[model samples]
Target: MEQKREISDEQRFCEMRATVEDCNRFACALFQQLSAQNSGNLFFSPASISTALAMTLAGARGETAQEMHNALQLTQEGAQLHAAFQRLLSETRTGGVELDVANQLWGKTGYHFLAPFLETIRDCYDGGLQLVDFQEEPAAAADQINEWVSRATHGKITELVSPMSFHELTRLILVNAIYFKGAWEDEFEPERTRDQTFYLAGDQQTSVPMMHQTGSFGYFENETLQVLELPYRKRNYVPQFVENEDGSVGLMHTEVPGGGGDFSMCILLPRERDGLNDLEKEIDSATLQTWLTMRHQEVIVSLPRFQLELEYELNTPLESLGMERAFQPSSADFYGMTDNPEGLYIDAVLHKTFVDINERGTEAAAVTGVVWAAGCAQEPEPPKVFCADHPFLFLIRDRQTGWIYFMGRFNQPEHQAD
Candidate 1:
């Protein structure tokens, strides 16, 4: 008789891995939504960002410890998942946001197991998240979130979120977080950075402080995209690139060797520096997704180190990016912990991010939090595009995972002016 073949535990583990991968993809979609909405830079090492979001969402929903571990695929040796959540929490606290608020939103279902995952990783982040309760007053939460958004974006983004009344039994609050950091990729000599003419549209130009450098770099070009690499002053920081295909110019950050580090791409459309109206209209989730898929046949790129500090809020853009379920109280499901079926549904999802690019490379941080409600409600605006006519930067990232966060620019200055 033929011997019976048994299914091995590793095989079972593969099935589990498949499930985790699906969840990972879902979480990545959410992050991509958040990133696209803000038109800001995002960075995450490996699966850190995705795992953090999944663990938080699972914790908020009252998932069992086993369920959380399974969903995030937390292995004993790799602290990737734990490290990511810790970084996020740390960043939030750094911005003076209360941890109690995060717990209130996450602890609703008594799923405290997930809390440790967040608490454990809190030390890695450097930002903040604030909670605004709307039940006490109409639009109070929205107003507070809006203020944080304004400040986080350095006024580039304004009024992205608003409070309203809805039918859900849970009262709602808005959670917001913001961070800022500056680093040198290839630190410019103080003498090398000087005022130079930055060409605006047509003949218009403005004198801006520009940094200059010349070094042998990893260079490549294709019909559709031009690629140039500029390594940071810290060799540990990988090089970044710029790709201009057709009219849309974007920053491309490729996957680092050995599959480590953060990867991102930024697309800038020039608009009046005063407002984001024009920038908003020209780009949406679909526009960004399409850009990612566009074929670049041949291209050339060269980018020099310059200084930039960018800030943007993600609430409005996230909703447009297809995470409506998490923000909607009725659609959100978090009833596992308490008997009060309507007690702790997510009321709002708010995020703020900031970054400063200089010679050191890119050093930045962001924080995101979800608010719960006793019950609720709910926008209009003409969109705009910031034409990115000048020497602007961009990065290309893994849309599904945000794994390799890289940065680069579309225009290179001819010389550094004094």
Candidate 2:
């Protein structure tokens, strides 16, 4: 029986791992769709979006649930899926960084929802249901929900929900907010930052402030792309190796604690300055996972200091990913959320994100609302060069779980002339 219990625990972990894999695919699909629409800068938080949708999924049933499951490529079903979410959310702990993930459900004050739905959210997602007057005071309800999101994100995302999006039929709104701030393990000296020429698409160029650093980082490269992992500061130290007198390297297990982290910002720079489009075109889950593998080695990194804030309405993009019925009120089926025969359909999905990457590190916040609707690299013999002087792809993710929190592309650089 003990062996069986261990096996059961392992299987549950596998299920959770599968969920992360599915989220990787979902991120790729979303980036492909959104990138195609916008030729400039693009950024979004897949974790935030997935978490909010997962909350809604707790109350979804029938085809609605299956569509979401398929679109997300979720492996676990029913209770297993929620349990996976619970563990995943709990496992995102790191000591030296400020990482916060918050979820909440705002339901109509008078609307009657199934107890199981609310309980599942509270238990698995740590999201408690908050009653609001969406029926009579839609604007107030939006403000209340927005305030929660803003607080969760440390004001990085203040107005995620617009009052105009609320309607009489909008009975529930699910929200997920994530905020992360981590300094680079080896921070760039502000004095080293200088104006550099960043090549943009269409043979354009812009002067931007680029930070420079020379340190051992996770690095990888191929004939087509160069990948660099800039880790954030975390609690405790990571294993490092030093060359011995006998020309051998040995692991230094004991070091100053709190010198490394489990979170990193991975930048994928194309071999050719203008190869971003082709690189992006070839992105898929398998190829992406391949690119993320890296070895720790000495690297010369040059990264631009940029800030971006963007909003997206994900209805069409999600529909394109085979989640069609959820947006269609007539065809949508969310019977598990409430006893009402006229079930809830995903009315709108609004997402807002803010990221500031400078010499210090990265401070990012993303808030995703389902509106209920219900709705790095390796090492080497010699130091490698990873200069983001042109269009490139970037991902902020957990080094341990391979879960992408935020992903984006930097195409046109904002002028930061010193």
Candidate 3:
């Protein structure tokens, strides 16, 4: 008889730690760029963006590949990188969390993509190649792509690529969609939620529905801010199920914290009313890693019910991160994709994210579309009143793998910027 092995929590954490570093680095650069542009309500999935680009990178060659590797901080190559991502993605699909990651490649009809390029993505990312006629009918192609994104993301992300985005210039478009909807382990009382004033920067204030809960949660804080971990429900008992990629034993854990809660929300609230900007400056890959190890404490958590939707053009920020070659039509070299690299370059990279947090649990979805145009959270403490009335950062992370899925800031209950 042959024996099957399970990935230890420690191993998954380490791999996710490495992945977080790369994802956070890119995220920091992007946030800084958006801040410079005076953008608001920051929300997107670096993991989704990275995953789409990683699938594209499988076809990148020469300087394009090297530059991308450097920019994304992906030092591993060939077998090592693929295997690691495969295992990590598998390990993250815990039983209690509803997470679905899908990939697809849409190329201009009559375009001959190399066998190795297709094989690598299929093997590593489970990306299926789909043929679409962009050169002849761009609008129809855009509709098809958008329809897929809509279905994959459960309609949260409808328009990933606009009709005008597609034309005779397009060659290959790689897409990645991740949908996650998890309910909190400790359910919040709906009746406890009431309208509260949310403090924005300076004198701005908005009325929002705030949900209050008191429980023993994993908490941490510093002089400048505080963090609270709201864990999601896990499987309670085992049933008829097969091996899951995320190691979530179905119904194995009825509640959270005991059987296993692979998903959680970490809220970073600034100590000061208007310290969100300063707080963002202090957070990087290293700082994030440090916060994960913060000890948990019992406290009261007061959180606001909110929904956030965001879309961004990521060419500038990713280019600034040292991935300039891949975006340049002339200099870009994706030879591994096809024999000739003529007029084949990243046209644009687009990302869309939606998050809804209520009294029950959280529902979030993210979609990253690489049209070849391309591109590329916190804590608290107190007996913790955790009154997040002001601007604060938050993220949906996998505790088992340390992978961050949805990252956002709550600056307003309505359409307002952070």
Candidate 4:
């Protein structure tokens, strides 16, 4: 008889949680950095940024890699980290939600990227490679990269780079794009949506379209904030803990064995309308994980129907997080990416994000390009009218894996500046 072997569910969950926990820590740090620079409707994707950085880290060496590990709080080593991410990518894809992740490497002609680096990303993360002549045609190169990102994000992040952002010296660009669309397990009724007064910072106010619903949702409260969870519809995908081709611990989707939490949106509403900043300051990994302990309660929910598009240049924020080495032209060591040792260092890190929340559900996308470019819900009540009428922190996550795909605050709604 053939010997029986198996990967325990605990082992796979452990690895998946480890990676996502790292992502959570990185997100909190990045959020603090980005929050310091602005007081508007702030939004960005830590998952997208980290995925792009992981690609960069794959080609990093010496102190550069160490700096990234420290900054990213990545505890796993090269191969192990990649394996964890691969497992995570596979596990996330096997759920009820529509979650798509894509990675692409674009190198300028005449430059040779090292084969080992290429192999690592391809095998571990399934990255696709493309060659573009950034040296000879910077504009065309930018357009090509932007087009790929737009498509990957389902046109939500319509573009990822501008002509001014890329130049002839650019040797390579690594891009990561994530797209997600999921409906609330219990959705809002459109007829109930009405224009309501929303208090803004500094005692300002605006009439915004606020959607209302009363339902049993995961709920928690503290002196400073109220937490509500609006779980996404999860009917289709059941997870099967299976071994991948490499015998790596991963999951496969099959007929229902057991599963839930395909996707969910968690909203953190500050007690005081302007206390969002304070509430944010209190968030760390423990707090977020603790907040997820929310119990089901009949709460009244009032969330604005909003759509937002945001673009940001992340060089300063990343450096603030102690990832300075990768951006320095002289000290940056991404030699593993190319034969020309001095040829490629990150030129910039650009990011774009989009979200549209309505009565039906939620649609969001994010694209992060390391211009080697380089580098929700709920509630009921009073059933509790948990009105997000002021600034608030929110997250959309894969509850099973603790993967936060989107996170941000809505202080005051604003039109896209671009």
C-alpha root-mean-square deviation, each candidate: 15.5, 7.3, 6.8, 8.4
Candidate 3 local lDDT, 179-221, one digit each (tens): 8888888889999988888887789898888899898777778
Candidate 2 lDDT tens digits, 92-156: 76656789999888888777899888888888888888998876777888789878988999998
Query: lDDT tens string, model 4, 1-418?
Result: 0122245788767766789999899988888888889778777888888888887898888898888888887877677677678788876743556788999988877677888888877876788788877766778888998888888988887777766766657777888999988777777888888888888878688878889998878889988889999887765666789887898988777743122456788999989877887888888888788887888878889998888788888999988888888888778878767767455677788888998888878898988888764320434336666888887888888877778888888877754221
Instruction: Return the number of clashes found in candidate 3.
Output: 26
lDDT of 1 by residue, 12-72 (tens): 4453344334444434444445444444334322232333344344334433333334433
Best by lDDT: 2
Ranking by TM-score: 2, 4, 3, 1
lDDT of each: 0.38, 0.84, 0.78, 0.80
Which RMSD does model 2 reach against the true structure? 7.3
TM-score top scorer: 2
Over 4 Å off in model 2, which ranges?
1-7, 237-259, 373-380, 416-418
The C-alpha TM-scores of every prediction are: 0.46, 0.91, 0.87, 0.88
Those runs of model 1 whose alpha carbons end farther than 4 Å from true positions after fitting are 1-52, 59-185, 201-203, 233-315, 336-339, 376-391, 396-402, 405-418
Cand. 4 TM to true fold: 0.88
Q: Model 4, poorest ten-residue lDDT window?
A: 373-382
Between prediction 1 and prediction 3, which has the larger TM-score? 3
Superior candidate under lDDT, 1 versus 3: 3
In angstroms, the error of model 3 at 261 is: 1.0
